[model samples]
Target chain A: MTTAGQAPGQAQANLIAIPRDWAYDFLLFTHRNPKPCPVLDVLDAGETVSALKQDADVRTHAPRYRIWENGELKAEPENATDYWRDDLVTFLIGCSFTFETALTNAGVPLRHVDQGKNVSMYVTDIQCRPAGRLHGPMVVSMRWIPESLVDMAHKVTALMPSVHGAPVGAGDPRMLGIEDIDAPDFGDAVEHEPGDVPVFWACGVTPQAVLMKSRPPFAITHAPGQMFVTDMPDFAYRVG
Target chain B: MTTAGQAPGQAQANLIAIPRDWAYDFLLFTHRNPKPCPVLDVLDAGETVSALKQDADVRTHAPRYRIWENGELKAEPENATDYWRDDLVTFLIGCSFTFETALTNAGVPLRHVDQGKNVSMYVTDIQCRPAGRLHGPMVVSMRWIPESLVDMAHKVTALMPSVHGAPVGAGDPRMLGIEDIDAPDFGDAVEHEPGDVPVFWACGVTPQAVLMKSRPPFAITHAPGQMFVTDMPDFAYRVG
Candidate 1:
């Protein structure tokens, strides 16, 4: 979620769930395509407890909820009290917002934050390693990094592998089958300075893309930039 | 599996299978516990083909195999042809040997290789992020590195996240609940020099540990030091 204007410990709860039978398949899909679907936490079927946060409720904490049926968005409800099912399983996926603080702290500028727009995203020709009835091309978010600071940005983000670590590709949009950088599939495109390079990182939107393509019977996900806030610090995701 | 003394492209294929219904759960388990269970490739139910290699069969390639039933060792068959089932699914998990070559090339010596013994491993008090019916304390392998080269060893292994990534803990065995470094739970313990620091990494033995603890109805894994070799190179696991 966009951590741009939010305080460090602000409330940004968002929740998603799927049928219990499909829960294992969904977890497998995320595992097979980890960069784009890093799992932060998972709740067993019919469970309301949040391992990442103490005494947190998934059904009502999120400021907003989206209902999806057969790959179509059907409602934007204030809470999922009526939709809650005993057979539903919840998963807390890592979001790019988890690394934004580290990136900014390391002196890497973010164009989306500066311009007040969602990060530009594109669908790539790269097919994700498929797992059981789920397969689709990867989706990546683009950022313009000063050529000199690219390595610093990479290092800063690489520290947190849980949140789509490092740039998948940099300096060329064509390599990812993006024909026009200005015309992104999702989010708004921002301009790059003369010395800036187009850098791309795997986006969480990739799972949404797979859902749209595979058309699972039922599913739910956080709205773009609307993530569930966890008590875990960004540093917790870093590796030695 | 140990890469020492084995021919580079030799037949080291080992196979394991579980019920078709548990396939997604098994895959999800590996995905949830990636460091110790790096999945190299997976075969669809009833299929003998490997996406990572051409003309490879999971049932017969490895020099050895071990069978487990309801969490207990049942057999050590040379091949699984007699046990093959149409409903079985095969997965090729990433082995630490994938990163051993790089570690050596970076000038870090491996004690297990020098002593011709399996690397030392221990079951830590750290519980892994669980998936479905699988949950257990994390298991790790121990290696002694020259104090000055610990950073280099970390960076070398960090590049390959698929193969357990960097050391989870180093220099302090007590932090991981290891009462005595010399008394490891698995593999052979090696002596450490005065200036050598003990580095611990997520081990493939972790899934086995989970299997033993959770008592899954049925499960199979490569024997320690006996892994499924793939056509993919070690470099393939590296990231920027």
Candidate 2:
């Protein structure tokens, strides 16, 4: 189900599954870290049907699934049937792709998308408000918006708080303990043109980073950039 | 610490305490219902000091507390020292007072406050997104804002997503299944002036309603309108 060569906008063709018993903990994790782990939908244990998508199967619909055990990547299976359990609960998290669309609609250009590069992400000194055993520095995705459009970008993204909301910081990476703007902890960095300002929004990679650091005994998450697409329209997330 | 006779905007001069073992579940409940249960501060198990306030004591700070067992209100105590346990976790939820301050700063008048009546609240047909065993209809607080100030009210309140971002509905109460504006499931109803629009915000009472319906084995929350006062300023909740 992998769509590796797909167009720039089409990613997130997968789902992540975790043991049902840990479902509440994971939900708490996302709630405590709204910007990085905005929950789009959730499926109860033993339920294959998605509340966000009709005819969607949690096991087979996702083009890919990454299984992590004790903080180690054990498998990237095409389908999770072999690991599917009645007690496994599924969660669909909001992806930045939705906000990127909103930004584009508001006339903000995405340099990374234009250059066909992954948006640059960095591990910052900012500590996420912890929930249970999940605690780690917030991961943020940086974009270069024209100085004039920075406020517009902020408003556009702020309308959708569920998807990381507005940028956590703008102008200075050093303030966030990011020593180098050219180097990122994850993804490819794009160049900033003249008159552009460096802006950062909470990255969805945060949960994955916390999982890697905290090393929960068992967990599952969609591979980076591969999310579970929902039937809900982008505008559905926008608020007044 | 009770401020019962204080003027409007000076309430929330108290704190509530409960058993520490149920702290995580209670935190999960607040996270799932942020609007009604905005967590202003949380104390670790066995800790009585709140990170949000200096010289604050959870045991004797709150003027009053309502204890619930098996979903029934069992006690209203002036001090919870008798019930305090090492594992009891305490959370301070965000109150409408924060958003009302924002609205006032933006030149929007709160009718309930001016009329010296409690904000009208109703149990809607809309179901709150469930977390664990907690699930119930969303409860909303309604205030009448002049038609001209509705947009300003929205922009002001939307800045505080932690407290209940924007009005879920503005003009017609019937859209939210609220049949009579004069009749509220909770709180006193305030009169609407000519050209006033009834605006609804997700209420903090929602989590309480959910707890009552779901009937968690044990739980504790501030009595309505009697919230935990945090040293944090109201503007802290406002976003760009």
Candidate 3:
């Protein structure tokens, strides 16, 4: 059994804590590298009110925090007590951990994880439907599937809707309106060998881009890689 | 085929328009009665620019409009040109009419249509999740189903999510927090036979009740029964 009070570093990293405004940038950075920074929880401003989990204090839960101002990196803080507000709304969107587990269980080889590099992400010209003040093109994470099991790969991942769902566009990346797949919008570019169709799924970084574009007066999100572990079982979000 | 030049009477009766300050009440009413008053659209007070449908001139689209002043049905007019403002945000919600066709097509007997009376509705203890200024108990429409096929009835109606989408409660009226099934909160109640179960679907009149409770300074909704005719096909909203 993995206890919440195991390693001090892992415990503090997983705990919820109220982060300073500077923590926003750190979280955004983590969101950029979704494979490593899969978000599990977000605390609105003020006293880290626990919405999805119990005893999950946002002030001192996570070990570290980063802040961003006007899309620029600002500072990193152990906790975010000074940069809290009353109007902030927290969103506990799905993380990629669930999908990674599915892929690994299904015997799909992951290149980025194996090479110790960030998963490839790119900004597609295809626009996401804007919600309220949030508007931007979609940022997709790519995975290369071998020719033999591409169909099975799609079928397996398509079951999880909340965790980014099935690939938005498969086959050629150019069809998704990307001019140069080599120069991705964020993250490192990975080599795609023959017989591997680059699969893309809407990344959790979508909300970050939305947050950046909307520029809400005040907001708080999970620092990437630091996630609030929940009792919510992953299978609950899956569909047949 | 329903001709376009039908004087917009039935469609106009579906329009719910109010002054700028009453926006909150309008949203409330939508939450309360989700069936009959299914919010077809909202034209924010000052942003009179219609985007969802053409010929929906907020000021003069409906053949007739009702102005509610402090819960009182005060004035009837053809246009709200004098009450235009810039702060309003229009919302196009789903309507029950979108699903009624499906129910009839599936051989579900609609008593109100057969008797030429308004579908019966009542306020229940079921409270809708509050969003911003809108908050209130849910109102539901009652229907009768034969004893043998009640399960099939639920399966048939559950398919239409945009419309009311299945009964919230079945069998007993008292269980719905409704007393004296004949005395409906709004609309006239119909007779239910010995072998019939009183099935209820979320009512569209919810927004009105919510709007009245929230009491935004200005708001507007379609007068009951009248609706905006949309260009999109109803099947477009159905999910398989």
Best by DockQ: 1
* CAPRI category for model 2: acceptable
Candidate 3 C-alpha lDDT tens digits along B1-240: 111223211222244545544444344344334443444445544655344457566666644545655555556666766655566555455655555556666777666666656567788888776644556777787777676667766776665544666678897888879988899876667776678778888866666666667565665555444445566566644433
Instruction: Give the residue spans of candidate 1 off by over 4 A.
Output: A1-16, A147-152, A171-183, A189-197, B1-16, B124-130, B147-152, B169-185, B189-198
Q: Candidate order by DockQ, highest to lowest?
A: 1, 2, 3
At residue A160, candidate 1 shows an lDDT of 70
The 10-residue segment with the lowest total lDDT in model 1 chain B: B5-14
lDDT for A97 (candidate 1): 66
lDDT of 2 at B21: 45
Enumerate residue pairs that collide in model 1.
B13-B62, B38-B94
Best by lDDT: 1
- The CAPRI class of candidate 1 is acceptable
Q: In model 1, what is the error at residue A26, expressed in angstroms? A: 2.0
| lDDT of the candidates, in the order given | 0.75, 0.71, 0.56
Lowest lDDT sum, 10 consecutive residues, model 2 chain B, at B2-11
- Cα miss at A147, model 1 (Å)? 4.5
Candidate 2 residue lDDT tens string, A94-208: 6666777767777999888787776788999999888667688888889999999999999888777766777899998999889999999877778888999999988777877
